[model samples]
Target chain A: MSKFLLATLLLHIPLYIYPILRLCYWAESPLWLTLLIFIPLVSSQYMSRFYLRKKNSVWTKLLRRFADFYLGVSPVLLISTLLAEIFVGFHMVTFGTAVTSVIAITVILGIVATMAALSPMVKTITLSSGKLTAPVRFVQITDVHIGSRKPAFLDRVVHIVNELKPDFLCITGDLIDGQGVSEDDLKSFKSVVGPIYFTIGNHEKYEGVEAIARRLENLGVKVLRNAETHFTKELQVIGIDDMDDANQVAVQLEKQTLDKDAFVLLLYHRPRGLKAAADAGVDLMLSGHTHNGQIMPFNLVVNRVFDMIKGLYEHAETKLYVSQGTGTWGPIMRLGTRSEITLFEISPAQESLFPSR
Target chain B: MSWLDEGADVRSTSLTEEFTIDLYRETYQDRFIPLFVVESSGRLRVVTDKADIPADCKIISLIKSDNI
Candidate 1:
């Protein structure tokens, strides 16, 4: 067996088995009957992920959603099964009691995580810059993963952005993951009030960058490709294409004829470009790739992986803001982390009533 | 996984657009997804369909596992 399939079987088999065993104990049921019921439930994730997934196919959507949802709440189910097994094994509780308790815990935790995923919270950050003559408000939405998301979701996001009435909108990266949805679905942005700017994401490249960019540009989005444009005489907007290189920001910035006098706002997809942006004298940098891990323990893992996983960080004069993403990626669930849309209010020193305040 | 794709730099070319996943099943003897390397940018992807592989992408190595 390839290491991947073998590893998958080894991991999923145990994760699925315990939950079934717990349910069997709860009903005092035969193993065969429970297996019949739970096998399809637990196995759908693997079936859809490994075998096939077509975005437009009904069967594919159902199977993928089933699996993706399981992928999200499986952690809760597994942990509950473990605790239930321990409780019954130690004779701390009756099998029925242990099983019932586990079910309750899993259901509650699952709902909480699901709710967190569904709701996108607005995070506001204000910055004071002496260079700006007036206040500018911008809303950032990233990692919406449109194929995994429906058009309704985008409509709601656009509605919220319109309500916020930002001067402009910035989509850092990962706007569209798969090609299932087309320009018709993304037409929700037509209702939006201001100019939209975007940078290339890894997924956009994976699906095909030229096509995605062309579609966005046709919709009047400024698809910046290692390119820059002036938002104002004092503020410049630059978007460097998403790359796996550590020095991507530095290398791309080196090529740009930077207006050193302008307050530079650089947009790159990943959170790895702070030092380089700072060195290039960028005042602000925006990114969204980590998704704040999208789940509980994974957030801890994401922290170890990226020096700056989520939220804002300052390196020298440059301030970098890494969003938690406006949508879930794989599992469509969030635990301990909320889906986010960030709003930035860049104000001139003159506008501030109290400079320190 | 994008980060993991940083250094692999493999892109292969196929003569025809008719290249399908069955072609992969024929050679790799595996039922799982296959890799596509974009010839232009040298980007590697774990894609499902032949159509998912860009026109310029090349098929590189295929990894196989026992049927589960």
Candidate 2:
């Protein structure tokens, strides 16, 4: 009620004034610029409260503090921007021509800042980099939770995946929200024509592993139920079912004819057993249980748990890249984090062993 | 357990939020079934009843089930 209004106003105010601020900054009008500073200053407290509600539990008091933090920063940013503009405008008003140039620079900086803050969900990631290696191009998309609110979203994603021209595709986990499992939605992956590999995340376990496994297999995806296989002569890819058992992975590795020198890629739903994978000598690992805090400030929560929270990292000579995910899980809005389609270009480490890319 | 990686030697804490009781009910009304639910205490349980609540765990969320 009161909270909702405050939240909506706080969220929408920035969205509303953004365009006006751009206009004022572009025109280099001091009066309009002055107005911009005041509006945010006055609304800052309300905005902070709004932000707090979204971050902490509705029942928690920390949310109120966050609101205060946001409001507190509003005046400072406005004053700084205003002061800088005044300094420039004073110098430019004397010259007249420099006003346009100053405004242009401000606009450019604003655009860059906005882009940085509102980063896009999709990303292109290279699995193996540097010189000398057989390159394997693959795309990994995790947490694609398609539902009524987000129907046909995969169609766009499929188009993007196809544009990348990946040799293979991997879905680490959470293909759907699990509640609304439909035949049409299940067949969405049919658009993915390449050798698609999958591993069950916690969500798949909710929908009946066997049923989901059969359905995915029907669509031509190789759903790995604690299984290992080789994609090429020099590459051995293993898909482990989601669990905490490191011994099971070791046992599975024992049965496989693993090429010690060849690249090994392991797909597990959660970001657990990273050290074990490194010890297992797995060349790479891909995971996506943490939606990287699908909403803003929540990612701070994710940062504390996983070493490689999102994006690429190296540990014990093994490269692990965690996807922020392609789809939103619960909330539709992603404030701080972007959904991603990670692309990996694998290249040979040594010329003698693997085939040329 | 669909989440824990017993195969690896290293283990880390779970990286997800608990499935709120409210969200679980909403998901059921919307007909979205949970694939699995792991409690905060590390108890892993799969959903056997379609009409039942989605996973009530604090550290995990649902990925899409392949079963249509």
The residue ranges of model 2 lying beyond 4 angstroms of the native Cα positions read A1-120, A127-133, A244-257, A350-357, B1-68
Which lDDT tens digits does candidate 1 get at residues A177-204?
8766688888877776666878878888
Worst 10 residues of 1 chain A by lDDT: A47-56
Write down the DockQ of candidate 1. Answer: 0.02
The chain B TM-scores of all candidates, as shown, are 0.32, 0.37
- What's the distance in Å from true for residue B48, model 2? 34
A1-357, model 2: which lDDT tens digit per residue? Answer: 699678756654443354336436555669866696547644554543444323434443343433333332332234344555675667644323334444455445444433432333457665443332568888898888654124467777877888888888998977755444665676667777566888878777765655666566656576655555556656666777675554645544443334576678888887766677787888888999887876545577678866667877777788788888777654344545667888887765554575777
lDDT of 1: 0.75
The CAPRI-style docking tier of model 2 reads incorrect
lDDT (CA) per prediction:
0.75, 0.58
